[model samples]
Target chain A: MHPAPSVIIFTSFSGLGFGLLLFLGLGFPPVTGWVAFVFYAIAYALAVGGLLASAFHLGNPQRALKAFTQWKTSWLSREAWLSVMALLVMAVYAFCAVFLDTRLTVIGWIGAALSLLTVYSTSMIYGQLKTVPRWNQPLTPVHLLTLSIAGGALLAGQMTVAAALLALAAAVQVAHWQVGDGALKASGTNLATATGLGTPGSIRAFEPPHTGTNYLLKEFVHVVGRKHSRKLRMIALTLGYGLPVVLLIIPGAGHVLGLLAVISHVAGLVTSRWLFFAEAEHVVGLYYGKRSA
Target chain B: MTELPASTQKKLGLVIDLDTCVGCHACVISCKGWNTENYGAPLSDMDAYGADPSGTFLNRVHSYEITPAEGPAQLVHFPKSCLHCEDAPCVTVCPTGASYKRQEDGIVLVNESACIGCGLCAWACPYGARELDALEGVMKKCTLCVDRIYNENLPEEDRQPACVRTCPAGARHFGDLGDPDSDVSRLVAERGGMDLMPEQGTKPVNKYLPPRPKQDVSHDMDILAPFLEPVAEDPKGFLGWLDKALEKL
Candidate 1:
């Protein structure tokens, strides 16, 4: 609920796009010039997609420029400003690469920061929203940060360090997700306990206060209501994570591991993000007479 | 060159005594009265008096009967609207300049002209404070009667928010929350006030003092006896069929 696909795509693509550019510029070069150019274009698409999607969430997309004025206090405004700054950095880097030269020392720092900020701000957007307690925690930002590094690592050429970082991030992510799931369960238990109920069982009720479904229920309590999809979710995580590991080290992917790495990470992340939003319980859900699961 | 314009200063807000609010919704009606005429557009009722009655209101008084297992039913009337937080999240979340927290006095106002009618602020609010005015296609909320509070034509004391002015029980109070020594601040301090949803961390300036009036159930022993009946029997109204069907079959 805290994140939309625009945000998801922005963080992931920006990471890959900027990450590839930075890695090639810093560690390896000449050969990855082609990769860098392609990634810059990919990064641009993702960033613009994110910006457009974010605009829809705004009351006035045309007046979004005003967000730059409040960068001192608001994280969202800072995000808007930083995103624009990132685009400029990217454009300049591209220009210099073609004619003059993309300075590894100067533009590298900018690209790195752009990737970091793109992911960081995207994380902070949800991290700051206090209403959704699930997202308000620091783990939200940490998860996004790790995700950036993971995306960057997947784009690595030969260094085992990249794979190591990816593995470390995956571990942290799994641990954090476990903690989050525990927190969610604990809160549900606490709510049920507070109402003098023992283990929430079949607490469904009718009589929604509003006639038409409001945005809250639709977005937050978006239970699929189908048993089959739940099974699909389990498989998504398994295949997403499992296949990538197998493809990376099995020595069969040849030079194609890079592409597979990108696909697997994105697929796994999409599944995780979907579960993250789907599993969260809104306090208002209780008012509609929802029993704790 | 230094410029200083002479403008009358009035800190606008509402103070509801949780003890006295009878849940009759009189303030809600009066609020509807004032905003209907003064606001850019009226709060629309989707289906008035129908099966599905839902609409927008500047104020709504909710009656919650808080019953203590040891005692009787204590009806707590909560009239909720915009609390006008000192650090308003709704204003901050707005991607457009439509939502603004006025520096003049910390009143969170949404400019209808500039608003694109995005509901981000509504989600940001844990208290469900802001509502999108479907008729105007813009965000609308309790303005604290800003138009009337400084109308100048009305008497000095009469120029107050409709919620404060029309509260029959004198439960609602309006004053400057910024001033530490203001009446509203003092009332909050003296009454040990709490907020509607404090865990939200929005730091809402508006405070609701505790109203734990004990209700006596001693006189209604006969009526209350049924409440203690076995809850497992037929909460869903299916126990009768199972009991009768067994004998018939």
Candidate 2:
């Protein structure tokens, strides 16, 4: 809920990168030689860069290797394992596609599925948190996957396909906001419920636990104004979805237009991702008598 | 390793009485003092004694004002720490297997050596129990004072969490709640101890006793009328009689 910078960068770029890898693994754009090399390079850079950005947020980056071992329970662990598998598979597939100029259908298909699965695992890392009611929903994964695929399709230069996926992603984003905005209110948690003091009447915090900010306040009790959030959402809708859709779908929309669409979509997505964390209301805030929903 | 056991052998936890806590913060200070040295990493402080001071603390006391529709408002002091839940999401969400719930006593702990400090366990906890040590880059939380509780170094009577031992009001109790005959279990039954935010379904081991019902102490006029009798004047005069009458009133 902190809207941490490293996390925002990691989620945004990695989703797009993986989305592109999925398309490439499935043999989209049908290119070979230098053109294919450039695509693979961009995908790998984005994907790897995003992974490094994630590691940067860790307090002990050296210990991150241990994260791969807890896949049986932790979604973050699953994400680590899945992303590694997806990246490895994509690397081999890229080798065959660029060097041999022939896509191995089985390997290609496997890589594509793994790529998508990796993205899903990333989404699950947030979605599994019951403390943050805004993210604990089926729509979280839907939003992540749709946005990744749409962004991927755009970067892969598949204008027609990207347009349709962008539209779908936009719809999912809208629905996600519609549902997530009300999730905290729907959850039956309040200060009384949080403290197990359900009798008497409404509860209000008389004295905070500490005078200065603590880890909980910094990490879980973020507050974003409704007016600002509303304005950001409108900007996100216009740039992330609207402009990209109009630009990509217009007749005679050349490479310049496609690139512009990609830029606008990425910008819009950044805003959306910021909202994704800022708007999330952790249930722990109820203990402070903050908004429950 | 991150998965919780089917059941813990004993549910060792704290039972806090909200009715008696005086918000003295003795437990908070004692916990910080004992844990900062006892634990592997010190509970680091940033900008301490400055304009804005903050430090990692295992236990914290929060006060709340509860106003009933029919009566006056009451202030309640709440001391919070890890509940060591049976189905702890914090343990399950640990990516590096650093966070775990002890099978022997159901006491949740963090293996500091393995913690990557991604802070997921903190995010998963509803009580805001875990705090990331910014200096050490690791997550730390209340271990229920496993070191002190199991230590043979001190007197047997002192085998409890620093917070519980330091509580001045006797508001804190620690014991195995698994046994129905235990003192804690009886207290919970008698005092109607409750789980905080049960809907989260963590099945917390610790419990909180709600504040006692308030009583009205206003005197009725009719009951006091007979007691307000005026004294008769003696040779001293009206002043003496007036003093006696005022005292009676």
Q: Which candidate is the best by lDDT?
A: 2
Give lDDT tens digits, candidate 1, residues A1-293: 54456545545565455555445434444333555566556656655665676565554456666657656555666777877777777577765664464444677567667656866776787677665556667788887677566556566454355566666666766666666655544443332222222124412233343446444455455554346446645554454455566567765556677677667767876766665565555544443444244
Question: Each prediction's TM-score against the native?
Answer: 0.76, 0.95
Model 2 C-alpha lDDT per residue in residues A1-293, reported as the tens digit of each score:
79998999999999999999999988897767778899999999999999999988899999999998899999999999989999999888888878988778788789899999999999998999888889998999999999999999999998999999999999999999999988876766667678976442567888998889988988888899999999999999999999999998799999999989989999999999999999999988877666634
Q: Please give the lDDT score at residue A72 for candidate 1.
A: 55
lDDT of 1 by residue, B115-209 (tens): 66656567577555677765565777888888878799989887988878888888898888767689998887888766544544455666776
- Model 2 chain B — which ten-residue stretch has the worst lDDT? B213-222
- State the lDDT at B60 in candidate 2: 90
Model 2 spans with C-alpha error above 4 angstroms: A199-201, B219-249
Give candidate 2's root-mean-square deviation (CA, Å).
3.5
Instruction: For candidate 2, write residues B19-69 as lDDT tens digits.
Output: 999999999999999999996799999999899888899899999887777
Model 1 CAPRI quality: incorrect
**Per-model C-alpha lDDT, please?**
0.62, 0.91
User: What docking class should model 2 receive?
Assistant: medium
Roughly what TM-score does model 2 have, to 2 decimal places?
0.95
